[model samples]
Target: MSMHMEQTVQPPVDHSVSYPKFLWRALRAATDGGPLFYGSMTILTIVALLGANAWAKQVVHGMAVTDMTDHVSWGLYVANFTFLVGLAAGGVMMVIPAYLYRDDDMHDVVIVGELLAVAAIIMAMLSIVVDMGRPDRLWHLIPGIGRMHWPISMLTWDVIVLNGYLLLNLHVCGYLIYTRWLGRTPNPSWYVPFVFMSIFWAFSIHTVTAFLYCGLGGRPFWNSALLAPRFLASAFVTGPAFIVITLKALRARSAFQIPEGAIERLLSIVRITALINLFMAASEVFVEFYTGGSHTASARYLYFGLHGHEELVPWIWTALGLNAAAAVVLLSKPLYRRPGVLVAALVMTFVGVWIEKGMGLIVPAFIPSTLHEIVPYVPSATEWIVTAGIWAFGMMIYIVALKIGLQAMSGRLVRSDLPPAVGAVPQEAE
Candidate 1:
């Protein structure tokens, strides 16, 4: 006698919740965490508050309170902006393998990179706003209201690309997470085209930022044909390095299971890109030293100091050492396999790139001055506080967003209290 076996079918869940309810659930998930999470949030909040207070003092007293003067109008603020832009662009590295190359493992965790990009971009925008000294001046860059010299001004291009990239990431990440929460497979039509567009847009954001510096005829320090490529190379290094560290942390701290393959792929990218970044730096150094013209003044001031102003000399060397060491560690197959060593190396890489791209790149350009006057720029206490606050605020945003993402990925933050079953039809909720 043949026996017929019947498979039990799961009932179709509504999987549809109002947008406000969805948001409320997400907020709750973001706020609910263990002691370590709460402690981190508290620290970030305190630092952010302190930063806000410093910003208020700066606003009341005006830009005069800061060390920036006629010689160096741009200081710590712009340096941070430059580095964060690259960090944001570096996020695309994760997307490329996931979407373009069809790496299923990468696709599973690609949202982590996207969320990081979103936070980095937000920090970059805040950096620009703070740099403006008078926040009201931003109205001039606003479309329809302000005379944004679009097509003509590189700054205008930057505003467009940055904001556009930010929106693109927001939409893609949100859609994917929401769909996952509904336990439905994402429709490629909704996010695929934009995902591809974001890849090109990522390159554009950094390229435009590089052009912003190089287009200035007076700043010989930034007027290099290799500037854009160097920015991208370093971006690839920082972004992947950060993601590697984050993935490891997630694996250890949470129920989230990041595929070991994802980490390996990211490390491989960092290994190659770090060397490329170093090569570009070396090439630029060769050109600057070999050419040895008046234009080389900035390079000289950066590496060896000009007119006895050696404030930045030590900073640049430290950056170089950190980057070289990180690259060596990453390239060593056996060393990177060790979690502790890998995290340390990634930290070094992140800090190294931050210094290399930030103060090391931005400050020296103004040292010798256009008229050959030596006026060094130093970040005042107010600038430091404000910078720290911005960083803290960005980290808070990243941490909260990550929590929500993890919940959604794990099917814990769905419309129903019970876990979502597979193959549920996602209902459209207003």
Candidate 2:
């Protein structure tokens, strides 16, 4: 018998109940009590405080406190931000699998991507703030304020799209869940705007983010049109890898059960994307190395090793190896279906892509600098801690979002006690 068939075969139990109690029970199931939730939240809060404190100190002292100099304009902050924006876009990919294809198996997991997108955008906004020399003056970007730059810059456009997209997601997701919460069917008209907006907005975030880097002509690596597409490819790979891991975690934790084929199907999608991602990376590498231009030296620095800065070389090679191994494992149907192999693929892709985006995105712009000098950067302890803290924050949000969604779907949380059918008995009354 198939896995889904086996799961659907149920033992006898009480079947009659009101929707409200069923929903309330689900809510209790989702939110009741757990050390994992409390512990993660507490750790995230402390780390966020530390990060905020570090940011304040840096602001007071000025940009001089950061490891970034004039030569290395973009560093860890921007790198993290870039990686996360791609991760957020990963949700759009989920839409393709769940909504477009009507893959019912992934229906429960789709909202997890939406929540992940929300948390990632938050972190991306934070990273940008932390990178700025005058983070306090951020109000200038707001409308009716100091200076509202128009079509002159993609950054301005990006700010608008990012925030707009974030709000749209919150509204759509909120409406869908709240309607369920209130024991009412959602209006079709309400979701129409969001469905359209989300599709366009997904392409916008990463495209504009790429424009920020590529618009700078002096940087050869960022100049290519391939950069934006590359960002999207990586986003699809990493975002789903994260979702897969979270699904596994949820399966381990609660009474909530993900049906059998769901995981293998998702893994199949991950494998396909990983292959595409690897192809894109390989193509970029070939274009850079074989062409042999001013940027070739810079590309070489990233791939093989540089004379003085050998730190990133080993890491990059390992990243390449890990990604290749992951792609191979995922491509094998038998291997990818196994839980152990599936988890390994997720880990490999996750770590590989992080390094690929982190070092790959940052280092290239610095090499063959406008000043024609090579500069090596190492993120300070403060930078590392802040990055970790921000990541922890995103994970915490995903966990909570999953909890609420699980309860809402499982008939445990109900907004009201209402009867689906009414029984009438004749009686004499005055």
Candidate 3:
């Protein structure tokens, strides 16, 4: 009896999944079946489309139509580009505390910071594109066909690093969000290493952005050795302040439970960075005033009257006062404890940093150009429209990202092996 045991063949497991289905589920998650989500997304889409229209006009008219003269090579767009890069890089502060310091509250909301970074970088890239004389020729940055001189050109380095950092964050954030969508806890193996790498990568992005300005020897305002540290410190202050404000908004309405001390943690970070930033500013002022020279002309114009051009003086002083006041508010024992007061402080801090890094910083640098001719650069009406449009578009991106992240956290997204019963809400951890 040849006992040929009947081999029961196990059917091949159908592990193959459809990309279209995944996308459909992801879209459903982002939509959230809520009017608020859809309404906000609709508004954002409209604004983004308007921005596209503005960009089209800019592309057709050429760079000459803008207020940027030859003396001020970089105008509003470049100034915004520089600022957005800092904002994008500043998101890393949240990452460091959450991933490295093991702050669970930060970890809960860390994705929000990453989402902000993604949107800011996207905006930064758009700012660069719009500022370019011929944005259509941007493809030249690609390797092989394009003559991007590696390591030799800082501009080339910037292009490479910005895109690389963007990719790294997208990969990490996308994986986490997607896994959460699938209702499966993400494997640390997938994203943990990338998160670690991104910390340093974030520093590099902001440093390179600083170098872009400071490396230019011709610009006295930007040639300071302290510019790099100043950039980092201000970034540390401004970025956290922005996040704190945003988190406060979310907590006020959104269902996601913000960690108990997340805002407090950010407040602490802001206070430290704010002090450092003020110290750096004082140092720069002292050196500029003490070593009076033609190079100091720009600084003189910034803080004091230069040939009766005292327009920036008032603005700079206002920014300084706001910054100091914000620092004081944050450092206050009673005020910092109140949510409203904290938000006010952060608003002041963010606004002050914006002015300091923006009009206060960039405008003065080019006020009395290298020729000593006081050729002031102001944003034209068209420039303002373009700026507003871009800003609206960026916020749109951020809002959508946050929506998706919130859906993921709320467990309403496409979950694996644990889908909620038809129309039923998922159970909360608490």
Candidate 4:
């Protein structure tokens, strides 16, 4: 007999699972963490709960509970909102290198940046909601349900861009993670276009936020043409600085070895952007002091006391000091190379940007009210609590998302029905 008999062909493995199953697996991965993870989550949850209680009290009582007054209407919440918007926008820095430049190392961790954007945007939205006092009125911003006043109101534009950017990031991250969980290669056509669009969208969110402030002719301090550029520059600095710290943490704590090259690239970005941010700030200061007009009142009050009032004087100086110190350390190759020094520099950069964008920028604008009367605004304890809570909540979201992402990227969170993916492992940097 011709032994060429019947050849039995093995069928290709399906390796596919239901979307619900994929989600379940992702949840399991996110929940599976060490003691440190659990402890951190618990602390964040406690803080978030405290914040929620504070907000509940605020809702029951009114905006009067906070320190806000008619003269200084916008306070801590709006300030946080402004800073977080820039932070969200900053995520595009990672995406630019990963997708646009085709950087493999960056590509591997770009999802972290995108996920950070999602968390930041969520916090930013919460900041706005809390600032509104009557959170229920948020429905008014909806286009169909309420009057969005599109094309007319910069606030409407802001709502659109922020929500759009949030959705874009969510889609990109969700699609990538879900597809990977299924042990399938993500289709470039599905997410590539959105990733590129997000770059421009990120810019728009911050630019529009800047416009929202600068568009106010009444607020001379915010009416600067340079505000948008300054926002972008500072965003780049804070965004990459944050990523560097996160990458370092991942390398230290997690199985996923984040590439040193990626951290170096981010450090380089921070060095350049930090310098640019400082230059822009200096330019603004020079222009404000040189002009010596009524508009300079806010700037003067911010940098130096505009009379007997010097509440913000200390705040602005501290922010400047921090920014200056961070830039110095980041620029110093010796310091930047040391892991501890790099993290400290990045933290300083983040905090410095926060103060610069928050208290330094927002409060000063309203220091001398429209009637030219000096009225200083300070955040109340409730405001502080709520702010802390929002931050904690954001951290919680970020940590969970990061866990899911890392697990998926490592090929550890694949379809349960299939064996561990063969040759599907990503080449992580050594």
Residue 88 lDDT, candidate 2, scale 0-100? 87
TM-scores, all models, native as reference: 0.93, 0.87, 0.90, 0.94
Question: Cα lDDT for residue 384, model 4?
Answer: 98
What are the RMSDs of all candidates, in order? 5.6, 8.4, 6.8, 5.8
User: 68-134 in candidate 2: lDDT tens per residue?
Assistant: 7777777888999999898888877666656666677776556777777888888888888888888
Segments of candidate 3 deviating more than 4 angstroms = 1-19, 33-43, 420-430
List the candidate 2 regions with Cα displacement exceeding 4 Å: 1-31, 337-339, 416-430
lDDT per residue as tens, model 4, 345-425 = 889889989999999999999989989999888899999999999999999999999988877766767877667765444
Which wins on lDDT, candidate 2 or candidate 4? 4
Arrange candidates, best TM-score first: 4, 1, 3, 2
Q: Among these predicted structures, which one has the highest TM-score?
A: 4
The alpha-carbon root-mean-square deviation between model 2 and the true structure, to one decimal in Å, is 8.4
What do the candidate models score in CA lDDT, each in turn?
0.87, 0.73, 0.79, 0.87
Local error of candidate 1 at residue 423 (angstroms): 13
TM-score: which is higher, 2 or 3?
Answer: 3
Task: List candidate 4 stretches off by more than 4 Å.
Answer: 1-17, 422-430
Per-residue lDDT value at 340 in model 2:
83
lDDT of 3 at 407: 63
